[model samples]
Target: MLFIFGISPKTVKTDQGQFVCPICKTRSAYEIKTQRNYFSLFFIKLFPVSKPRESAVVCLNCGTHMPKMVLDH
Candidate 1:
């Protein structure tokens, strides 16, 4: 019997809005994404492991990831 089990991270886009990028200083489309770790079996995701949800805001123009504090304002 052979079993392949591992953990993988999957990112999902939760929201989309416009925001001013601090680095680029341009109003551009931004995407809010969340990443979660999943338990994989034979390269297929079976369930999620015990891990905190990771969130980030990305700018479409300059591809910069803005900090949470900056995005709040």
Candidate 2:
């Protein structure tokens, strides 16, 4: 039997997201530029999907690092 856990695969539409940088420990935030698919190829290597579902948020300041997911409904 396949073990079922966590939220199922789905596409959530939104216009914004938020995250706090660990180093700065400040409310550093950004805006979602587009919607993309989340992928997990072999539990060991999980990351946002590439191609077709290609979209990302861009930091207004430093243009580096991965984007933060909006966890709260």
Candidate 3:
């Protein structure tokens, strides 16, 4: 018997809002994303092995990920 199993991270867009990008230093559209770790078997997603709601803020223009403090402002 042979089986291939591994964990993969998948990022999903959850929300969008306007924010000032620290890296780009400009007001732009930011996307809120959540990363979920999935267990894969035979190249197919079987189940999630970690928390499915880890979030991040991404700048649309510069494509830089911002810290959680960026969302507070």
Candidate 4:
């Protein structure tokens, strides 16, 4: 059960394939991935970390960005 509910910020999705800059509509963009590793402490039991998920986001044009909240299991 605990293994299902993970972290924040899911993946990157674009409406036009290329993310449009909020300020200007342009194809120019860049990607950045964030990786993290940590141990989870619980009162019932001690669990081992299986794998670290790669959370990412991209800035389309104007450098404006939003974080993805949920993901499919």
Best by lDDT: 3
Candidates in order have lDDT scores of: 0.83, 0.45, 0.87, 0.42
Residue-level lDDT of model 2, residues 1-73, one tens digit each, is 6643332233444455555544444455655554444554333324445432444554434544344443232
TM-score of each: 0.84, 0.31, 0.80, 0.29
Off by over 4 Å in 4: 1-19, 22-24, 38-50, 67-73
Pairs that collide, model 3: none
User: Residue 50 of candidate 4: its Cα lDDT?
Assistant: 40
Worst 10 residues of 3 by lDDT: 45-54
Poorest stretch of ten by lDDT in candidate 4: 64-73
- Segments in model 3 whose C-alpha atoms lie over 4 Å from true places: none
Better of 3 and 4 by lDDT: 3
Question: Candidate 4 — which pairs collide?
Answer: 21-61, 21-62
lDDT of 1 at 43: 92
Model 2: worst 10 consecutive residues (lDDT sum): 4-13
lDDT, candidate 4, 1-73, per-residue tens:
4653433332333332344444455556644445444343442223334453555445645555444321111
lDDT of 2: 0.45
Residue 31 C-alpha lDDT in model 1: 90
If ranked by lDDT, best first, what sequence of candidates would result? 3, 1, 2, 4
